[model samples]
Target: MTTNLTPAKTSANTVSADEGLFKPGSKLKHKKSGGFYRVVMLANIEANLAPAYVYESLQNQNFWIRPQAEMEDGRFELVSE
Candidate 1:
């Protein structure tokens, strides 16, 4: 039997799909901390399949992940795409 491999959608009903906002290598800045980061890619949480953004810190090169909704909730401003 064939098995479906498609990933599940996010559980957030209010948040829209992450499209045309940013792409891989896009630069962003945190509004509160003024820290800068670069977009690595869009990822999903393995446990719940929640959409998340995979990014890297420009200051220390540490990678981080945040839910897609929070990432677009005015906390992070796009610096360059």
Candidate 2:
């Protein structure tokens, strides 16, 4: 199944920029491991509300979640949209 990550709509009906580049269905490559992955969704930690990216490995189909800050900290690079 493919999921599209649309920008969140606010009370003003404007699209929020919080989604950044890692949208659902986007393909990415790990800088260190050189593995490919596909983004599944964006989620927030229940306890602290920290933003995170939910993604699955293209090779093994294993799901993984990483903090948004860490995901964007030069660890992964966009491979495809």
Prediction RMSDs, each to the true structure: 7.6, 4.3
lDDT of 2 by residue, 1-81 (tens): 554554333433232235656878799999999999988777765566667778899998888978888988999999898
TM-score of each: 0.75, 0.76
The Cα error of candidate 1 at residue 75, in Å, is 0.4
lDDT of 2: 0.76
How many clashes does each candidate structure show, in the order listed?
0, 0
* Candidate 2, superposed: residue stretches over 4 Å from native: 1-18
Model 1 segments beyond 4 Å from truth?
1-20
Best by TM-score: 2
